[model samples]
Target: MSKTISFVLNGRQRSVQVDDPEMPLLYALRNDLGLHGPRFGCGLAQCGACTVHVEGKAVRSCTFPVAQAAGAKLLTLEGLGTPERPHALQKAFIEEQAVQCGYCI
Candidate 1:
């Protein structure tokens, strides 16, 4: 019952076979697409660990339905930058030495 769900991920066109369209986008990104940037902090979407950019706005991927992301653009921590070229935020975190469970570090 997996249906093809296509969307733009990290500035690239991507698709996945999602049997449950209602499945959280977090699971699809992590389990199916192998993106560990967004973590399942709280299933209730209370925590901010599973935060991602949808259409350039930060949204909780844990409670976001996979089907709802169709045709949308997504950006995870992985998309922000790489070790050789970390994003500005990553550089700020490094400069301030902020520590929070090392989720995005």
Candidate 2:
């Protein structure tokens, strides 16, 4: 059965229909919401590539259940800032030349 999961994404209200509530939140964010900020690194959640903020805490979206994120606030990299005005961390990274492959930023 398809279940509707609602959450605050990037300061906007959003909802997605998930067949399995246990499905990873990353799939909903990436495939359903069309967000490319989070990447699937290690499915084991050892890597922090799929890290996203939920309820003001960092979480590995790869293993996080979409159901658990219902009615919660989610913040992805895209929510940080725009190209015209980058976030402080993003600006610092560019100034310090910390960006490399841009995979695990």
Candidate 3:
């Protein structure tokens, strides 16, 4: 059965309908809404590739169910910074040239 879920994404309130409550939050962020900043790495949540801030705390999106994220605030890389005016993390990463293979960038 499909259920409608609402939450805050990048400080913006948004909602979507999902058929499965156990579906990973990463899929909802990337596939459903077309937010590509948080990438998919190990589905087992071993890697930190899908790290996103949920209610001001970092969470592994791959392991977090979409239903569990309802009504919570989510902050992905897109929310942390932008191309025109970047955030401190983005600025630091670029200034220090800390990017490897452009994966984290």
Candidate 4:
């Protein structure tokens, strides 16, 4: 059964139809919404790669259920900043050359 899940993504209101309410939030964010900031490091949630902020708390979207994210505020890497106006951390990373493979960055 497909269900409509709504939430605040990157400071914008967004919604997606999920075939499984229990589907991982990562799928909804990446596949459904076309947001690729979060990567699929490990589906077991052991890795911090798929981490995203949910209601101001860090969550592993790979294991986080879409139903639980409904109506919550989500923040991914893309939400941090843009190329023209990068976030403070993003600017610092560039200046310091902290990013390597761009997986967790």
Provide backbone clash counts, one per model.
0, 0, 0, 0
Candidate 3 per-residue lDDT, tens place, 8-104, comes to: 9998998988999889999999889999888888888888889999999999999999998999999998898779989998899899989568654
Give per-model CA RMSD: 1.8, 1.5, 1.7, 1.7
Error of 3 at 7 (Å): 0.4
Any idea what lDDT model 3 has? 0.89
Q: Which ten residues in a row have the lowest lDDT in candidate 4?
A: 96-105
How well is each residue in 52-78 modelled by candidate 2, as lDDT tens digits? Answer: 999999999999999999999999999
> How much is 73 displaced in model 3, in angstroms?
0.6
Candidates 1 and 2, the one with greater TM-score: 2
Worst 10 residues of 2 by lDDT: 96-105
lDDT of 1 at 57: 90
Clashing pairs in 3: none
For candidate 1, give the lDDT of residue 50: 95
lDDT of 1 by residue, 80-100 (tens): 998999999999999999877
**Residue 37 miss distance in model 3 (angstroms):** 1.2
CA lDDT, every model vs. true structure = 0.91, 0.95, 0.89, 0.92
| Better model by TM-score: candidate 2 vs candidate 4 | 2
Rank candidates, lDDT, best first: 2, 4, 1, 3
What does the lDDT read for residue 97 in candidate 1? 95
Write down the TM-score for model 2: 0.93
